[model samples]
Target: MSTKFNTFILTALASSSSFGLTPAASALPPVTAISGYSFTRSGMDLNYVAIEFDAAVLPFEVQAFVSKLGGCLAVPENGTDNFNAAISLVLIDTGAPEDNAAWLGIVHTPAGDGELHWSTIEGDSVYFLAFDKGGSSNSPEAPLGVALDAHSQQWFDVTLDDGSSNIRRAVLSFPASMLDCDADMIPDALVLALGLGEDQDGDGRLDWCAPAGDFNGDGIIGAADLSIMLANWGLGGETDLDADGTTGASDLAMLLAGWQQ
Candidate 1:
């Protein structure tokens, strides 16, 4: 699709749309910190992060996926429309050694407002279709939609394009509700693992017990275990095995080879 930049900025409104929030054009959402993962680029160019929303999040409007090449796109406080036919999602290039390409896909609901959107990092070429509700005949566009199986997780591959020397970084964002929690009940071991209470193991034993406090899977909870836990400290995908957010020696020793005893 030909690249055309539009300057029309709309005010934020709490419309019936599920995507939510429309930040002022001048402002964007803060860069999200994705724990346990790192993004690096070989060249001096920039990388990008894209987000896809679940249809349940915005039940009233036609669902569309948006990509922000280098950063995040802020949803305006007021609702915004993606089918306006004038505005296109913005693309940012970090100037890495490799070219930047990405994909955004939206799945429509059979009868409800629950659609699913996904994004993949592509190189230099991306396409999307503009669809209107009520299923009317529309212009056949090259970027409208591609043949895909929504049921498969392997629909796209993340790799460098052939003959391209540029390398870029990418990130993904989804609503918190998308995650399925552990049976709606936080496990005690997980809780203690996350550092939420004095009960180190949830096994009714004090942390001083040889078997209870050894978190690093090591045979003992000594200074070595403490060092390991301190190395992986943080939340959102790190080794919060106990489900608490902090990392301490207790968590470290749990990694010891035979600490379970």
Candidate 2:
């Protein structure tokens, strides 16, 4: 099993009434980079790239200094050793190399720890940073180590910007294993946002990434999800999984087909 952080703060925020986690907000589109938020993956690297928190979370002043907030996890391309199963994150300058902000206690894991889990990369240097273990010293609790033989499979360029419509990407590489790719690698935060659970295998892949008829995103198409579909019967939102621009009998039929899967 993979490690599970406290995630109390994130869960509270997620369950808040103000977030408007209706089907629309909860159903994360497949787009690589949106205007305000974007999370995508390539090979072993699941990139947060850029996360612009809404003004409701942080005031404008504190948010300005922040540029791109990126995190990545690398795993064996073939085997299941997951040598570098640990996840790490970094904050980069806003295209201005000299303006790199080294402020600690800013980036945090889902547990809301003051520090990132493993070593953080700044520029070309890698620094071994302590993990926020929520007052515990454990083995698996720590982030995964970087495999020495690991190297990036694909290249990514980060064109940093100051809150512009730019997506700055960060990549992590793994060993020279055969690339028989088969899963949609993504962060757990996105999984939870879509009502999926933690990565049970710790293999950097969610079991229910694209499950059919997950209208309510609770990982299942059940009564609650059906109710939502009925509520938005003729609308275009999360319930319209078919992208046919309507939530009618066709959509309802799909939900029924995948019930309790």
Q: Per-residue lDDT of 105-180 in model 1, one digit per residue for the tens?
A: 2222222333223221222222343323333222222112111111221112221112231211222222221111
Tens-digit lDDT track of model 2 for 138-191: 333233222211122211112112232122222232211211111223333343
TM-scores vs. true structure, each candidate? 0.21, 0.26
**lDDT (CA) for every model shown?**
0.26, 0.32
What local lDDT does model 2 show for residue 147? 22
Query: Which residue window of length 10 is worst by lDDT in model 2?
Result: 174-183
Which residue pairs of candidate 2 clash? 86-144
Location of the lowest summed lDDT over 10 successive residues in candidate 1: 53-62
Alpha-carbon shift of residue 20 in model 2 (angstroms): 40
